[model samples]
Target: MSSNRKTLWQIFRAPLLLGLLSLTGLIGALVGDGLFDLISWATLGSALAVIAWYWAKPTV
Candidate 1:
């Protein structure tokens, strides 16, 4: 991949994944499936992890 593409991905990765996982969790909750519940929880954890990672970073 080109450097610019890589930079964009790095910049957007967490927010993109967070949005996707949150959407998936919302859909799973609406559908009321046990499997999806588990998936949602896992995604939720990872989403929190991403938030924590960014939050802990020192500002430039």
Candidate 2:
């Protein structure tokens, strides 16, 4: 991979990957007619919040 692409992936990889996984699970749950909307939302929301927090204040 190009350095620029690698750098971009390094910056966004975790959140993007986790978010995609969460979205997939959320869609699966919804399509399966599961009554776990709140749980899914909370899980995804918390993941997003953590990602935002880390982006805002990254500590080495």
Which pairs clash (backbone N, Cα, C closer than 3 Å) in model 2? none
Off by over 4 Å in 1: 1-10, 54-60
TM-score of each: 0.58, 0.43
**How well does candidate 1 score on lDDT at residue 22?**
84
Worst 10 residues of 2 by lDDT: 1-10
lDDT of 2 at 32: 50
- In model 1, the clashing pairs are none
The 10-residue segment of model 1 with minimum total lDDT is 1-10
Candidate 2 off by > 4 Å: 1-6, 33-60
Q: Looking at candidate 1, what is the lDDT of residue 36?
A: 81
Top candidate when judged by TM-score against the true structure? 1
| Candidate 1 TM-score, C-alpha based | 0.58
Local lDDT at 19 for model 2: 80
